[model samples]
Target: MARKTFNAQAHSLCLLVLVIVDAAAARGDVVSANASGEAMAQREFDYFALALQWPGSYCQRTRHCCSSSACCQSNPLAEFTIHGLWPDYNDGHYPSCCRDSDFSIKKISSLMPELQKHWPSLSCGSPSLCHGGKGIRQIFLYLNRNLLRSQFPDEKKHGTCSYPVILDEYSYFSVALDLYFKYNITKILSNEGILASNAETYSVEDIISAIKKAVGALPLLECRRGNGLNGDASSAISWLIVNEPFAPFNVL
Candidate 1:
C-alpha cells in the first residue's frame, strides 16, 4: 500500500504531536492478516498525532465569524489551543470512529473549565444571529446547549480509537490537556522571540530551529498564505516514536 502523508494547509500556527510506532511493527513484519487477505481490524495504529491550532489565525480567516465563536469574543484567545489528538499510522492512514461510542458532555464535565479555556470550539453561529435581544449570557447558554446536543465530534472520531490505553473519555481529554500544558507551544515560541506580529517577519528555518532546540526534536513546519495579511502563517508539528513494551504516554 502507498504510504499516506499529512497535507493540511493551516491558516495559523499549528502543532502535531506524533507518536511513532516501532520499526518492526510499522514495517508490518508482525501484523496478522485474515485468510481472505484483508486486515482483521482497523484498531491498530502506528502513533498518535495531537494537533494544536492558533485562534488568532483561524478567526482572522473565518469570514462569518461572530461573538458566538470563542475567538470572536471581546477577550479573544492569543494562544495555541488543542485541535485534536488523533491516532495515526506511519503511512499516514489513521483509525477513526473505530467503535460505536458516542460523545457525552457529562463524561468530561469536571474538565469543562480547562476544556473551555484550552480546547474551545471555534465554530460560529448562534441564536443571536437569527433572533434579536439575546444577551451574551443567553448566547452562551444557547451555545452550551448546542454543545450538549452535538457533543464533541473529535471524541467520537479520534478519541474512540484510543481504547485500552486511553480507557475513557475523561482520560482521553485529560491526557491531551496534560500534554498541551506540558509542551506549552505558545510559551516556547515567545521565549525564542517568535511572537505573533503583523510588522515583524521570521524565516521558516528560525522557527523550526527554535522549536527543535527547545523540544530536542525536529518538527515538521507547515505554512499558508494569509488573506490580505502581512506574512504567511506557519504551523510547527513535532512527533516522538515509541517501541513495544513501552507506554506511549510516558515518553512525552
Candidate 2:
C-alpha cells in the first residue's frame, strides 16, 4: 500500500510539471505574436507619415492637380501662374513628366509635339523650327529666352549679352539650369563695370572670364535636367555637376 501511494505521488508531480511547462511555452508564443503585430503596426504608421508629407500641388484649376487637358500640357506655359514654379499650387499646372494620377506616359509623350506647336516663336535652335546656331549655343539661347526675367531675379541683373540670347526653335521646351547661372553671371559683370557696352571691344573669352569669376564668388550654381523642379535651380545644379550619391545613375 505504501509503495503504491509513493508511485501515485511521483506520477502526479511529473504531470503537474509538464502542465506548467506547456503553459509557459504557450505564454511565450503569445508574447512573440504580439511583438510581431506591434512591429507591423508601427511600420504601417511610418508609411502613413510619408504619404502625408507628399507634395499636394498635383492638382489644377478646372480640376484637381491632373484634371484638365489644357492644364496638363506636355511642355506647359512658362508664365508663373500657369507653370506653378513655387511650392504653393498658385498659377501652376502639373507637368506630364511628373508622376501623375490621371495622366499617362503615352499621353504626355504625344503632347511634346503639341508643346512645340503652342509656342512656335520660342525656339531652341532646332532645325525643324528656328534655324540658327548649333549645339551649346542652341541650348543656351533656349534656356535664356524661355526664363522670364521677373521670375528669375538673377537673370534681370545680366541685362543682355552681345550674343543673341534668344535662338530660333519651335517653342522653347525645357531650359537648362546652367543657362540661368551664366545669364546671372553676365548680369553681375555688367553691373560691376567689367563689360563695356561696345561689343567690338568685348570678346567671348572676356565673357567666359567674367562668368568664371562670378561662379567662384557664388558658392551654388543651379543646373537642371529638362524642365527643372520647383525653380530650385541651385539644388538641381548640385545634382547635375557634383556627385549625387543617392542617384549614381542619374548623370543628366
Judging by TM-score against the true structure, name the best candidate.
1
User: What does each candidate score in C-alpha RMSD?
Assistant: 9.9, 32.3
- Candidate 1 at 208: error in angstroms? 1.3
Residue 45 shift from truth in candidate 1, angstroms: 1.0
C-alpha-based local distance difference test score of model 1 = 0.54
Candidate 1: residue 148 lDDT (0-100): 22
TM-score against native, each model? 0.69, 0.20
Per-prediction tally of clashes: 0, 11
For all candidates in order, the CA lDDT equals: 0.54, 0.21
Instruction: Give the least accurate 10-residue stretch of model 2, judged by summed lDDT.
Output: 44-53
**After best superposition, candidate 2 residue 223: deviation in angstroms?**
22
* Per-residue alpha-carbon lDDT of candidate 2 for residues 1-252, written as tens digits (9 for 90 to 100): 211111111001110000000111111111111212221110100000000100112212224222222234455432212111111011222111111012122322433443323312221122221112222233323333433211222111111110111111211122212123233432554654543221222222343345345543212121221121222211212111212211111112
